[model samples]
Target chain A: GAGVSQSPRYKVAKRGQDVALRCDPISGHVSLFWYQQALGQGPEFLTYFQNEAQLDKSGLPSDRFFAERPEGSVSTLKIQRTQQEDSAVYLCASSLNSYNEQFFGPGTRLTVL
Target chain B: AQSVSQHNHHVILSEAASLELGCNYSYGGTVNLFWYVQYPGQHLQLLLKYFSGDPLVKGIKGFEAEFIKSKFSFNLRKPSVQWSDTAEYFCAVVSGTYKYIFGTGTRLKVLA
Candidate 1:
């Protein structure tokens, strides 16, 4: 794809339900990232992947948050026992290198009730 | 701990008005600074970035930013704003361990 793409543009889940967000990064991009954007706030880093390796996940807020880039091109972010506070826009970004320009996806807006 | 700070949460300006958005980060090291804009219902687009060389960086859509290392600041400026410029702007810095930290963001509303 020319740009990064995410699935389920919007998701509404009941509290305690588990939800998964997917991301398809640009072709052959070596670095991928996930971020959480609260309403009226900037995106916060959640995780990073260098190819298939999950190198950095220090920003994941809790155990409920888990992200994987199994094939090194597509990634999934799964949140277990979703809480009201988990309601936010989940963004995915990809870059050719670790500290270069990042191409972003439209993001998935999750609403937990 | 390193963090990015955006001075304004929301700003309103008339078309043709000059604009300036302030951004600051707390880190004393070599870093890469960037400015991104998100228009309504759109993904983030890079406005400009400063890795090295000149401190003043020019971006698309007549936008520019200045990187002041002493103040740890990268402020975005435009001589004249258009109604189309209304969007949310983000300031980010990539420092140690290749982590990208972002400010809270500034929402700009340009009224015609």
Candidate 2:
């Protein structure tokens, strides 16, 4: 079975640019999560979605960060006006349910210059 | 605020040596604990988890973790680590909330 997967393994963008990272969760997964991992740091939860409903977005750092999971399958994390501070790896994970073990993706590394 | 702590930042050991990594969390309630491993160039994968029942839980690759509620700790252990075990290990805790609070992670280098 295919695990969670993220597209554009690497991305480079200038400051003030907008970037979108996509995630494809495993088939039949009902829960999806987004996290940000800075250099030498653990992943920090950014948002969570149950099916097509966004359950939590409190972890998003600022208004520039947005995420959506329509159709209950694919999810996207978009950062507007990219900043140097936003340079980090974006990880996506999915689980059968909220309590089940999550399967992680390879992550998309974004660099803002 | 819920947070997880991994005291060891890095560890180096020889193959077949015993390994133990410390993980502690600050949350005042029932919690679920998990250990995840990320091999170089690979995605993070689950090593084990502790939800309830026995405090000692065994995971894949001869790994195990002990959840001690009194200490607010869940330490991962392996009696004999292999060279292939070199990877970054993360400890995460889920409290009443559904999101996971992860530790900074410990990078282990196993010498063959």
Candidate 3:
């Protein structure tokens, strides 16, 4: 079975630009999560969705960060007005349910100049 | 303000050496603990988890973790590590919710 997957494995953007990272969770997964991992750091929670419903956005660092999962399977993390501080790996994970083990994707590395 | 702590940032050991990594969380209630490993160029994968029933749980590749509720610690250990085990290990904890709090992670380098 295919695990969680993220697109645009690598992206480079200038400051003030907007970037979107996409994630495709495994089929039948009901929970999705996004995290940010800085250099030499562990992943930090960004947001979480349960079957198209955004339950938690408190982990989002700033107002420029936004996420959505309209169809319940595909989710997107969009960062507006990118900043050098936003240069990190965006990781996506999904689970069969909220309490199940999460499967992580090969994160999309975003480099903001 | 739930947070996790990994005391060891980096570890180096020769093959067949015993390995132990420390992890602690700052949550008081019941919690779930997990250990994840990321090989070079690979995505993070679950190594083991401690949910209930047992304080000690075994995982893939001869890995295991012991959860001590009173101490607020879940430490990973391996009897004899292989060279292929060189990777970054992350310890995460979930308390009362699905959101996981991860530690800074420990990078392990095993020499053959």
Candidate 4:
């Protein structure tokens, strides 16, 4: 794709439900990132991946938040037992390399009810 | 830990007015600075970036920013702004290392 793309532009889940958001990065990009942005706040880093290897997950808020890029292209962020505090916009970005400029997707707005 | 600061939480100006948005970062080593804008309902887009070379960097849409080493600042400026320029602006910094940090963001509303 020309730019990063995310699926399920909007999602609503019950407090205890689990939700998965998908991201398709630019073709051949080697770096991918996930961020969560709360209302009126800047996007917070979640996790980072270099190709299929997960290198940085320090920013993940909790154990319930998981992300994976199995084939080095498409990625998924899964939240277990979603909570109201988890309601936010989930953004995905990809760069050709760790030092290169990143391209962002439209983002998935998740609402945990 | 590294962090970026944007003091202006919200700014409003009339069309054709000059614009200046402040950005600062706390880091001791080499850094890459960037400014991004997110229009209503749109994804974030790069406005300009300063990787190296001259401290002054020019970006798209007549936007430019200066990187001041002593001040630890990279302030975005434009001689004039259009209504379309109204958007949420963010300043970011990546230390010589790979990790990038972003400011809280400043919302600019250009009155047409």
Candidate 5:
């Protein structure tokens, strides 16, 4: 794909439900990132992947948040026992290298009701 | 603990007016700075980035930002603005570990 693609542009889940969001990064991009953006706020880093290795996840909010980039290309962010505070826009981005320009996806808006 | 701060939460200007957005980061270590723009109903896009070159960096859409190491600031400026420039702007900082920390963001609205 020319740009990063994210699935489920919008999602509404009940409290305590589990939800999964997917991301397809640019072809052969070595770096992938996941972020969460609350309403009226900037995106916050959640996790990072260098190829298939999850090198950094210090920003993950809690144990309920888990992200995986299995083959270094596509990634998934799963939230277990979602809370109302978990409602936010989940963004996925990819970069050619660890330190370079990052291409962002449209983002998935998750609303936990 | 490194963090980014955007002073302005919202800005409104008329077309053809000059614009400036303030961004400051709290980090003493070596870092990279970036400015990103998010247009209406669009994903975030990189406007410009400052790595290890001149203090002044120019980006697409006639945007430029000056990195002042002493002040720990990277402020975005445009000599003249257009209606198309209306968008939400974000300032980001990347530390040695590659975690990109972003500011609160500023929403710009340009009236024709």
Candidate 6:
């Protein structure tokens, strides 16, 4: 597809288990972002990558959360020791550049039990 | 802490009603403002944006927004709304970096 796409539209994880969510941004997009959206709330910024370089990750909630875009096209967000609070929609967005409007993917909804 | 604020959490309106959703940001520097909408079971999509030049920006689905620098506000408006306009609207601000600070969002319900 031409738009951003994500895998496993839904995931349920047990406490202490680890989960990995994948994001495939639009082709040729130089800016990719990650966000977390809780029920009844807007998406919150998590991290951003300019190409292969992870530029800013100030919004990441914990050290256990890690994101990487080694090839600059596909990114992964991994969460270790899943907790109830970790249940939320993980959204990925990609833009032509840092200054352009981002196109989003149907987020992967993660549920921690 | 710099953040975006949306005035209403829920808005109930009838078809053909005029709509206005408020959004405000606490920032002093030059910034980019955007309004995004997410329909039921759909991804978030950009409605409009304000970077420079004219403050009034028109977006998809007959939606528009005005950027008021002095008030630090960018409110979305639609003259006549239809039932299809029902969705969750988010106001976001980007001061620097590529990341966006989004508001809690306003859920609008347009009744037919």
Across B1-112, the per-residue lDDT of candidate 1 in tens digits comes to 8899999999999999999999999999998999999999999999999999999999999999999999999999999999999999999998856677889999999999
The residue-by-residue lDDT of candidate 6 on A1-113, one tens digit each, is 78999988999999999999999999999999999999988899999999999999998999989999999999999999999999999999999998899999999999999
Question: Which sections of candidate 1 miss by over 4 Å?
Answer: none
DockQ result, candidate 1? 0.79
DockQ of 5: 0.84
What is each candidate's DockQ, to 2 decimals?
0.79, 0.88, 0.90, 0.70, 0.84, 0.84
Badly placed stretches (over 4 Å) of model 4 are: none
TM-score for predicted model 5 compared with the true structure: 0.98
Give the alpha carbon lDDT tens digit for every residue of B22-43 in model 3: 9999999999999999999999
Candidate 6 residues B1-112, lDDT tens each?
A: 7889998999999999999999999998999999999999899999999989999999999999999999999999999999999999999999976778899999999999
* Worst ten in a row by lDDT for model 6 chain B: B93-102
TM-score of chain B of each: 0.98, 0.99, 0.99, 0.97, 0.99, 0.98
Error of 4 at B86 (Å): 1.1
| Model 3 residue B52 lDDT score | 96
lDDT of each: 0.95, 0.97, 0.97, 0.93, 0.95, 0.95
lDDT string, candidate 5, A1-113, tens digits: 79999999999999999999999999989999999999998999999999999998988999999999887788999999999999999999999988878899999999999
Clashing pairs in 3: none
CA RMSD per model (angstroms) = 0.9, 0.7, 0.8, 0.8, 0.8, 0.9
Q: Write the per-residue lDDT of candidate 4 for residues A1-113, one digit (tens) a residue.
A: 67899999999999999999999999999999999999888888899999999999998999999999999999999999999999999999999899988888999999999
Worst 10-residue stretch by lDDT in candidate 4 chain B? B94-103
> What is model 3's C-alpha RMSD?
0.8
lDDT of 4 by residue, B42-65 (tens): 999999999999999999999999
| Model 3 chain A poorest ten-residue lDDT run | A1-10
True contacts kept of each: 0.79, 0.82, 0.82, 0.50, 0.82, 0.88
